[model samples]
Target: MTLSPSETARYRRHLTLPELGPAGQERLKCARVLVVGSGGLGSPASLYLAAAGIGTLGIVDGDRVEPSNLHRQVLFETVDIGRLKAEAARERLLAINPEITVVAHAFTLRASNARELIERYDIVLDGTDRLSTRYLVNDACVLLRKPLITAAIHRFEGQAMSYVPGRGPCYRCLFPQAVEAVGESCADAGVLGVLPGVLGLIQATEAIKLATGIGEPLIGRLLTYDALSLRFAELPVSRRRECPVCAEHPRITALEDTAEACAADAPLSVRRLSATALRRLLVEARRSGPGLVLIDVREPWEFDAGHLEGARNIPLGELRGRLDDLAGEGPPIFVCRSGRRSLTACAIALQAGMAAPAHLEGGLLEWVAAIDPRLRLVAG
Candidate 1:
């Protein structure tokens, strides 16, 4: 894999690095990597991989770019709204480095085509948000014996792990069973805009190391990152002997769609108050002398970041025990970063004998999206 004269000049910085000289640069030029998502994490991971001269790169996503995605999904621009993520990301990557091959897989990954799609690449980077799709990618990568760099983000936190076939445990080895859709995901639990960029770059670094055979990859350990605290910790992970996915006598022989692959949380049944409607109510109540009580279920730190005025900071962890304190507080409208915790809060309210429970429809994220971010935001 000889580098072209132009490529040599383009990767001068990489060539100068002792760890990744011309030989490593050539390996990168010949490596083929597949990034399974084009959102937050995948955006930075794929962008750097492309810029670093990965020979062939694939972007797989069926979602279209929306204004909401622009904050974290840096691959797409304002004009790219409504365009397929993979398509938009492919264009961006090519524009970054036309010297490499960029392939856009503008469809969701499913059981039927997971294996075939993964087989074409030397390494797999799974940054998908769905549990089902994450498991599917993990299983397919294990079956194909391709090294995988997988990472995920939650509100202000993220974790990454690598699986090199016989060297370390697969994603299943860490969590053998997929959970039925329970609780809110990051989509429902809002995340800081910059969190994924940190973990995504870790994925890119791991992929580069795996591609060029330098530096120890994040195998046999789960690397965790806390954005708020600016800290990183590692947890040791070992393969399970009775594990179904990657064990001595594995039960997961084929990539059949299991509960793990079909996992999603059950839909919630609760009264949702739209941000617009809530805003109107707040305005009316302000003029009429505090008619509505807003209960914020986010953590203290999140509440401190920004919250609706007149909201009470009752973190979800303390909501259940403090149910009796709201005896004379009137009907409360719960809120959180995303609507999930608020829904949970509503359920708790119902069980505590409240006839009805209501929450901000999209949480604070939705409010910010619909209204002014800086307006009416104050610490509880």
Candidate 2:
């Protein structure tokens, strides 16, 4: 297809680029790219691709725009909060490039539907934060022979890579095992807002370059960014012949949740102790022999307010680092406000092979309700 009369103005900058003249511009117009996650990376990637006149832009996101997203999710506004991210991104993107077709899927990408959705696109852009989703996207793209431009952001750091069909190493080849959940999400650890924007733009650049075959792709290379130092590093990657999906041996023939598989490998640290047994232990700790070390694994902010009188304080995120402090050869009764953190801490302690520590069956809330109904706990 020839450039439209209006296209000359819309993509004049692209036409001037030696690598992306009229011919390359036409290829972009004929290309279809599916971008996963309409947050941060998705927002910028979708906007730039649409602006560049990509023929069709497909967006898949299950989350909604939140007030917190306004900082970096450039495609959304305060008014768009609560609206599905995919729908909101489509509306904003079309407004930028009405010439392109913008299709929005307000649903999560799961194993069952991944193949069908990925098969429809020429390339897939992975902007998801979750590892499971990333593996799903990579596997589906490989099975369908679609190139994948992947990016991930954590705190002030970010990584980007490109996966070309039968050429470069897939994500699994680089990260053979799922990493333990370190509890440092953008929400918990906080982000600079501009980090995702930078990473997303880079992801978009990879997509554009790959589509036009302009520059050497990031295939088999991992680019690490340090927003704090304003420096970037590129690491070499090699394809694994033993990779379950991409390897020659190919142990994994069908689709599986890579992220979940990783998570399952190092499952949550907390396990349940029978309520009856816990109640009996609580009596034992209060009355006689070996005193139970009641530990509160909540944030200090939560601990200062009120906690069990004799409880030790160690936030769950930092628990793994402080395991040595708890290796006193006695059972510790871990407690948290709702039991979630405490349960998690107990799991960590147990995994460290600490003699199965106990959780205050119902946590601090239950401890107050049952053990000391009249205790004045500090309010958060």
* Residue-wise C-alpha lDDT for candidate 1, range 80-113, written one tens digit per residue: 9999999999999999999999999999898888
Which segments of candidate 2 are over 4 A away from where they belong? 258-380
Error of 2 at 40 (Å): 1.1
lDDT of 1: 0.83
lDDT per residue for candidate 2 within 1-380, as digits (tens), equals 78887987889998998889999999999899999998877888888889989999999999998898888889998999999999989999999988889999889999988988888899899988666887788788877779999988766777788999889888777654445453434466566788988889898899888889898999987786779778785555668767767887776667776544222222222333433556677677789877667778888877887766667888877988988887765877777765545655665665576654666545566657666665445543
Per-candidate Cα lDDT values, in order, are 0.83, 0.77
